[model samples]
Target: MAGTVSGFGRLNRKRSSNKEGKRKKAVYPEKSPTSPLASKLPRKQASSGLPLPEDDNEVPAIGSIYASPPIPSAPVSRLPARGFAGRGNCVDDTVADNALTASQHAPPDSGTVVRPLAGKPSNSFRDANKRPRSLSLDTAETPSKRKVTAFSEDAALVPTKIADAHAQVIADEWNEVARQSGVPEIAKITFINEIDHEPVPPDINTLFTYLDKDCLSSVEVPNPPKAETMPCIGRHPAFTDEGLFTFATDCKIIIECGQDCSAASNCKNRVTQLPRTIPIEIFKTVERGWAARSAVPLVRGQVLGLYTGLIISRTTASKLIGADAAYIFQLDMDEPQDADPSLVYSVDAFRSGNWTRYINHSCSPNTAIIPVARGSAHESLPYTLAFVATQDIVPLAELTLDYDPSEAKTFARKKYREKSRSKILKRKRNQTPCKCGTLQCRGWLPQM
Candidate 1:
C-alpha cells in the first residue's frame, strides 16, 4: 500500500525523548517577544532568566532561569509544540534567536542545580523559518486520534482486512490450513500502515492453504466419463493415466518419446506440466490485503505457474462467487464447450489454493494467462491457465494478472473499443473502479 499517516497528538514528538522535546520547544520563546524584560535583557539572560547550559546539547529545566536568591525550583512543562503555528503571534524569529543565543552563552549557576533531562542527546531540530502555512490535503483529511485503522480497498495502499463474524472458527481453520500447507506462522510482511507505528493483525482467516502443487478443492473431480469429456490443459491423474496431453502434435511426439519434462529443450509444453518452484513470498498489504512478490527477477514470457484451486461445477460457483469474486476463475474451453454454459467449470482458490491465489488484479497486468493445450491426440479446452510474464519483471515486484484478459487489444483503438463495446461493458455493471495506478490502467477492472 502507498504510505499513509494518521494519529493523535504530534506523532513526531517523543515524550521520553528530552532532546526532541527541547528542539521542538521552539514553538514558544522563553517569554513573549513583546515582553519588556525580553527586549531589555541581553541574549545570554533573555530565556526567562534560566541558567542555560553552555553546551547546545544540554536542556535547561523548563522554568524561570534567573534568581537573585534562587526561588525554590519548581517543575513546569511546555505544551504548545503540538501544532506548528499554534502560538500565532507569540513565536517569531526574534524571540527564537534570542532564546537560542541566550541558551548557548549562559553558564549554569552551581547554586541552582537544574536537572538535565535523561536519554541520549539528539541533535534534531526543525528549520526555524519553516512552519505550517496552512493545512493541506494531508492535514485536512487526518483521521481522528480516537480512530486510526487500516482496511482494504484503498486500491494502491498496503493490504489488510478483517470481518467480525465467526472470528474464532475462522482463525482456527486458517491456522490449521496454513500449518498443514507449510506456511510460516508469521512472515515479515513489509507494508506501510495508516499510522505506520502500531499494527493490528488480520483476523485468523486471512491466510491461504499455500499449495506448492495443485490439490483438489472443496468440489471433487467429476465422474470418469463426464470428466474425460471435459478438456484438459496440463497432465493431472484426474484426467489421464500418463497425465500428459496437449494441443500440439509435435509436443505430443516429443513427450511420448520419453523426454525429460523439466527441460525446455525436452518439451515446449513442459513449463506448465511442472510445479511452480519460484521463490515467491506471500506478504500482507496495507490496503490490498495479502499479496505475493517474486524474490527474483522474472524473464519476459517465463511461465510462472499453473493457477490451481478447487474445480467446482457452475452451480457450486454460483453460490460462492457472490461471497467473493476475486479468486474464482472460470475454466471453460470452446472445444469441450458445454451446451449449457452454466454447466461449465471454475476454479476457486478461496478455500484452498496456491501462492497464485494472492496475485491481485491490475488493469494493465504484468502477467498474461496462456492457455496451452497439451500435445495430445486432440485439442481440448484448458481447465486452468499458465501465467506468463508479459514483460521482464523485477524482483520483489508484486505479481498481477489481468482479470479480464480480453480487454487488452481494444485499449488504444477507438474503433476496436466501439466494436467491442458490448464485450467490454458486459461485466462493467458488476465491477468496481480499477486502482492499479498504472498509466495505461483502463480505469476499471471490469471483472474485479
Candidate 2:
C-alpha cells in the first residue's frame, strides 16, 4: 500500500508541473492550434467574431448582433438636430417615412435615387435647366455682295460704226482677194474699246504710256541714251476715284494720259503737243504688298505688250495668257483661284499694247472670263491663264469690275460711274438720262 501511494504522488507532481508550463506559455500569445481537427471546430466565444486570443483588442458583439443596438424608443424629440431643413430630431425618421411612402407609390423593384457615378452627369436633368449663356450679336452681321444691273437685250453687239464699216470692209476684201487669189485672206479685226456705258474722259488716254527718258531721268533709275529716243507708251489707267495705283513700285513711276488715246494713230499724236505737258503721276512699290496694284485691263483676242527691262513679278506671272495667275494658282490642288475674284476678265494673258488696255470695267459686265494656270518647268506650279466664259457676255451690258480685290471692299463701294466723252454722245443719241438707279447712283448731267 505504501508503494502504491508513493507511485500515485509522483504522477500527480508530474501532472502539476505540465500544467504550470502550459500556464506560463499561455501568458504570452498562445500558439495557434496545429491540429487540423481543432482548427475545423468553431470557437464558442469570440471578440470581433474571431477567436478570443487572435481578436483580444476588438469589440464584443452581444447586443450589436441579432439583438440590434438599443434604438432609444424614447420620444423622437430626443434625437439630434439636422443641419438641413431644420426638421425636428426625427428628421431622419421623417425622411425615412416619407421615402417609404414615396417608394410604396413607386413601381415595385424600382432602384433608389442614387447619386450619379463620380465624374458623370445626371441623366435626369436637361441642358435647359442650366443657366442661360448670354451672347452679344452686335458684331455678327456682315455686308453682302454688290447687286448690279444685268445685261440689256436688243442692244448692238459691237460699235455700230465699226461693226457696219468692218463688216462691209470684210465682205469687200474677201470678194476681191478671193477673186484674185486661190485663197481669200480671212481678216478678223479684233475690236478693242470701252464696253461700259460710261464716257471715258477725252483727256485720259486709254492707251498705256511708257515713261519718257527725260521723265525716267528725273526718277532714281536714269534711262540709257537709247531709251530716250524710244517712244513713250501710254500710262497705267487708274480705276478708283482715289486716283492711286496700287501696283506702283519703288522702282517704277506711273504716267497719266494727256489726251484720249484708246484708238489713236500713234503715241506721239496721242500726247497733246504741250512741252512735256502731259500730266504724269508716279508711284513706288513696297515689299509684302500685292503685285497687281492695279487690275490690269484684259480683252478677248487682245495681245499684251511686254516692254524690255520689265519682268512680270512671280506672283502675277500666272495671270498672263497661257500663263497661270500666280496669285491664285496652286498646282497641288485640283482647281486654281483668281488673284482677284472681283475683277472680271475677257481673255487669258497673251501678247499686245493698247488693245489689252481697251478692255473696260463693267458694273454689270456681260463677259465672264476664265484665267488658267500652266505649271512651270522648274516649279511644281505652272504659269498660264486659260480664258473661260468668253461667250457669256451679251451685246450691251456695261463692262465693270470691283476695283479692290477684296470682296468686302469692292461691295462697299459697289456703285461706280462709267465716264467718257463717247458715253455722253451715246446717251444723247439714245435720248436717255444717265441713270442706273443704283443705291450708289452717280446722277446724270452733261460732261461738265
Candidate 3:
C-alpha cells in the first residue's frame, strides 16, 4: 500500500512541471478566461484544428467591427458680422442638414475626404465673399419704360408727290428722241421712218394663191403695188377670223396695209408692228445658259414679239464664225428660180438684239416664227419675222421654238431604223441629252 501511494504522488508532480514549462515559453501574457479584455478580443481561427498564434497585439478591436471611429470636426473661426455681405445674418438650414447627412454615411477608413454635393455650402469654411444673386427685375420691366409718340397732323397731311416726280425724272432720262434718235430705250430697236398705219386683212385661203405651184422653178414673180400708191383699207382686220391664219395652207404671202391705210393703229392685222407689250423675263436655266420666259399668259396664235437684229447679207453672215454665226437666222422666203442665194439676207442678233436671242430650241416648240410684211416695200424683201405663240402658254412658262422643222421627221425615221436594225439600241448622230422636261421630248435636242 505504501509503494502504490508513493507512485501516484510522483505522477502528479511530473504533470505539474510540464504545464509550468509551457506557460513560460508562451509569447503573450496570459489572461483569465472570464476577463472583459479577453471577451473583447477577436476569437482565434484554427489551422487544421490547431490554435491560432498567441499575439494579442494582432487582434482588431471589437468596436471597429460594429462601427467606424468618429471623425474630428474642423475648428470654426469667428469673423466680424459685417463680413457676411449680401447673404444676411441668418445661417442656411439646407447646408447644415447636407453636411450632417454626409458625415453620418461616410466610411471611416476611406482615403478620400467627404464633400457635400454641388450647390451645398461646406461646413469647413464660411465664404463671406459670396454675394447673393440680385433680385432686380430689370429685364421684365424694360419695355414699359420706352417713350411713345404720335405723328403730327401736318406731317401726315403733306402732299406725297415724290413718287410721281421720280417717275417723271426717269422718263426724261430715257426719252427715245433724246437717247437714240427716237428709237425706244426699252425695245433697243429703231423702226423705218414711215408713219404707223393700220393693216388691211386678206382672204386667208386665197392669200397664198398668188404664188404659183411652180414658183420655185419660175424665172419671174409678180410684185405688189407700192405702199404710197395703195388705197386705204377702212377698218382694222381680225386675226381670230377662222381662215385668217392656218398652218394647213402655204400661207406664204404676207401683206400689211401701210401709211396710206385708213384703219386704226390697234388693228389686229397690224399686230406684228406693235411694241412688245407682253411681259417677258430672262432667267438662268439648269441645262441651257439663259432662256426666255413669258411673265404673263399667252394665247395660241397671238403675236408675242418681233425678231429684230442687224439685217446682213447672207454672204457676209457666212463669213462670220463662232457665237456670231450661231445666232444668225436665214430668211425663209420663196424666191424666183433664178434668184441669187448670195443676195439672201440673214438677221444676226448676237451683237445687237433683244430678249428673243435667249429663246432656246426644243423639239416641240411653243412658239413659231411667222412671215409678216408691214408694207409693199417689205413684201419685196423676205417677210419680216414675227414670233407667234403656237400653244396656249401659262405665266412663267419658257418660250421655245423648233430651230429646224425637218429635224423631227429625221429623228422619227432614225428611231424606226434603230428598233429594226438590232436588239441593242443605237444613239442618234449629233444628239445631245434634252432637259426640256417635256413628256414628248425626243431624248435629245435636234442639231441644226
Question: Could you say which candidate leads in TM-score?
Answer: 3
Give the Cα-based TM-score of candidate 3 against the true structure: 0.44
Model 1, residue 211: distance off in Å is: 2.4
Task: Report the C-alpha lDDT of model 3 over 1-448, residue by residue, as the tens digit.
Answer: 1111100000001011122121111111222212211112221111011122254212110000000011112111112111221233212334323322332211211232212111111111112112111212232121111111232333311111211122122223223212222222443211110111000000100111111000110111123335443222222232433212233222333445433344433334454544444545544454654567776787776666655444454445445443334455655343332334343445544333345655776767787665555454323333456666777799778898766544444556866547742232145433345566766455554433
**Candidate 2, residue 408: how far the Cα is off, in Å:** 5.4
lDDT of 3 at 299: 75
Writing each residue's lDDT as its tens digit, candidate 2 over 13-125 gives 10111221211110111121121111122211100111232332221111000000111122111011122123232235464334223211111112213111111211110
Tens digit of lDDT per residue, candidate 1, span 54-154? 64322111100000111111110011111212323124444433433321211212232222111111111231112222223333232212122432334
**Reference-based lDDT, each prediction:** 0.35, 0.19, 0.35
Model 1, runs deviating above 4 Å: 1-208, 217-269, 284-287, 335-338, 341-343, 372-382, 415-430
**TM-score of structure candidate 2:** 0.20
Instruction: Show where candidate 2 strays beyond 4 Å.
Output: 1-187, 190-310, 314-354, 368-370, 376-382, 385-387, 396-399, 408-448
* Ten contiguous residues minimizing lDDT sum, candidate 3: 5-14
Candidate 3 error regions (>4 Å): 1-238, 241-249, 264-267, 336-339, 378-381, 413-434, 443-448
Candidate 3: residue 134 Cα off by (Å): 56
